[model samples]
Target chain A: MPRLRIQIRDLSKTFREGGREVPAVSRVSLDILDKEFVALVGPSGCGKSTILNMIGGLIAPSAGQMLIDGAPVRDVPRQVGYVFQKDTVFPWRTVTRNIALGLEYRGVTGPEQGRRVGEAIRLAGLAGFEEAFPATLSGGMRQRVALMRTLIVEPEILLMDEPFGALDTHTKLNLHAELLALWEAKHQTVVFVTHDLSEAITLADRIVVLTRRPGRVKMIHEVKLPRPRDVIKLRESDEYAQQYSQIWHVLGEEFAGHAV
Target chain B: MSEKLKINFWRLAILVVGVGAWEWLTGIKAVSKIPGLYFIDPFFISRPSKIVERFFYLNSDEVRLTLWQMLLSTVESTIIGFLVGVSTGFAAGLVLGRNDRLARIFEPYIIAFNSLPRIALVPLVTMIFGFGLLAKVVLAWLIVFFIVFFNTFQGARGVDPDLIHSARFLGATEGQIMRTVIIPSALAWTFASLTPSISFALIGVVIGEFIGGESGGGIGYLIIASLGTLNSADMMVALIVLAITGIVMALGIKQVEMRLLRWRPEYQQR
Candidate 1:
């Protein structure tokens, strides 16, 4: 097992809306290992993005502890990269410039920055799109640019918040394969938040299911599928069926919730 | 033969036909003096060729103070006003935009202040700053600032929450996000602000000329003196000058906007 150890204790977030405090994420706890592609599966508005934000150190946790690489984080640490659900490429720059922005921000010096940017563009399967503007690129390609923008910084962990929820299934599958291949090579600690169970199952080494509003972890299921399992073959595998049954059983109950 | 040339020829033809009708109507005594035409007067509301004669004399130092000097005065005031207004507006807007709480408290007050006709301030600025180039520049600045400030403020604040969330997730510091995300978003709007702002800035200098005078041969001064003496031909010449100046400034700003916003959605759509 890779030593990409992660620990979170009593994580919570609350926001004031319409003069009332609304809980977003409630006292959630999880410890994920190094190079563990953890899929946070939940219904929409279940605070999966909130959890990802906390991990990325974009938003401070209202209460609780989170440790990545055995260190407590107060803010965005250099060791983390984030891919947003929507395209956030700078509209003033070409796609190539957008991808190279992180290197520029981190003060990565010349020649090397260009080379790494070129490599990342290729890695994200954004070849021949280096000069195109974000507006000119298709939705899938723009998201690819967004992913490569994060990849250029070469962070140890990646926090992806439903990065493909906007793309159609066909585009999503292509990107999924690209992402899997990229991860196989880099082996960074990845925490992906998604409502789509198929996406979660296809990508995750371990899937952590969360309950509805004010989300709390309900179950964590591990995958025993072989390395680099073809995503298309997932539905056919009995192991896939077993995993789906396991996740679905946990989800259907929590989805019904401990309701009145 | 080409589409562009065909459009251009039609526009030119429209101008010629309109002027011809104006000349015939005024010659026939069918129009009023308030709106002069080509045949209105020999010395006062003279024909287009006569106004063009005055415009040609714009090249002479004695008759028109030379074309270069008129251009220099207008260019200097325009540049100073634009720089002061745009920079101040951008800085204020960017800073205030981040503090939504503070912005909300002050927004109504800012809007009210902008609503008060700014032309009223020309006299106030001339009194406070004195009737010099500073007064003109200040007048121009006042005219240009509010439009730019409001547009920039909205642009910066209206950044999609998702983008900021993404930036924060990607290890961007607040300062980095402002420089990278907030400013770029605001710039597209700021460039738009320049069109109206340039027009306002020109009017400011003209207003300053009305109050203090660009001393001599200024377009505003020429228009006023021509009106006072009822030299309608010279007034037409000054009006033409003013229109040309406005077009040049507007076109210049549009060029800059095009250069800056080459990646905007409109650019791709076009």
Candidate 2:
């Protein structure tokens, strides 16, 4: 694949809690190829965000190496967009400036900056809201703004940490569809983290299920559903139930008390 | 232009009404004073005429180089002191806020120094700087330091962890993150703190003048001189002038804050 491939090997992270060692992410490895839309599905606090952070270079693995483009990941990738789990809008700037932020940091200025920001806003369905402040935007709109902000920089890879996790279920599903549409248009390698099985199943080209407490790659499901996927149509497919049930059965033990 | 003029007209009308009410009440002996309305008399304690006279004499070439010179002197001292104190405090606060270890080490020393009566050293400052510009400058700086330091420290530490993490995720270098997100975030807090910081500075400059005074002139010195000569009117006059100037300086900073911080939460309401 001409796209970026993230290879995680023996990665583990342990935090010192009350003079005792507690592991967040146990020895785990993952191989995501170029232009591959991969979903890391796990329950809340299952360290899905942690793994995304490790790949995004926001945190260091206590005991492992991550290879990107066949090279060791030491710092933030020069061409990767890391979307946060929450709205990342700077309150000081309007939606336009917020969207242009990554590009601005990448040294885009004047006409180029303005044009890129305009296109990003349009893509995010926020064209009429360029001058609107973040405080005024709805939760969904803000998340959309966050997405465009990262995507505008044209990174080869996109690492999103529960981008729409904070939104309502309806908003989350709608945004999932929106994101898939954008991804289909761009075909950028995306690693999305989420607790929602449907979101993972609907959006990912391949879904990697993670175990709870000292997170490890519990199982990997190849979402062989076809391109430009309609989430509704895909959900109704026989393969969807088969894969969802298989993964659910494996994760059902951990979902013990958190069945909801 | 018309809207603006209307607003100004309303402001001036309110000012006139206030003044007229005061003038009438005091003139008719509605208020009490030392030996009746004599002190309350606008013509005696801080007469408008006397302040106007002083205002016009701001640049006379006589022994007193006009009110302008004194004002300039006061302004120079105030600004220099404020900048020095603010910069130094910001630097120290940055160090302390980020490095809790360093803060723990020097915190006791800072508290001890800050708690001391800063005005008590006015006489000592006068002795060292010799009634010259340096003396006033030192006094001004002394007054400005603690406020700026404490506020900047709080501001620096109060930077949003979310913002910092966002910056790092966006591939912001440590320097860029500090310069763009953290500094601006802290600046909002710092400017808000500056409201009181500047008030303290006013006290600093005025106290310096009262304790000893600059080479020859200052509003503070004028107040003292008038008091020494039993000229309550002149003292009142100087007091009014100082009050007006102080209020104006504070308002000026506030206006700048408004323009600079249009994004602040306080303004987010309307």
Model 1, span A209-257: residue lDDT tens = 9998899988889977887868777768898888888898888886676
- Model 1 lDDT tens row, B155-196: 888888777766665666789888888898888878889888
Candidate topping TM-score: 1
Q: Relative to the unseen true structure, what is the C-alpha lDDT of residue A232 in candidate 1, on a scale of 0 to 100?
A: 77
Give the Cα lDDT of each candidate.
0.82, 0.79
The DockQ of each candidate is 0.59, 0.47
Best by lDDT: 1
For model 2, residues A1-260, the per-residue Cα lDDT tens digits are 35548888999988889999989999898888898999998777788888888887777888988888888777777867888876667878889988877776768799988888888888788988888878878899988988887777778889988888889977877788888888988888899998888888889988988888778888898887777888767788898888888888877767774545
TM-score of each: 0.90, 0.84
Interface C-alpha RMSD after superposing true interface residues, each candidate, one decimal: 2.0, 1.9
What DockQ results for candidate 2?
A: 0.47
Which clashing pairs does model 2 show?
Answer: B58-B67, B58-B68
Relative to the true structure, candidate 1 reaches a TM of 0.90
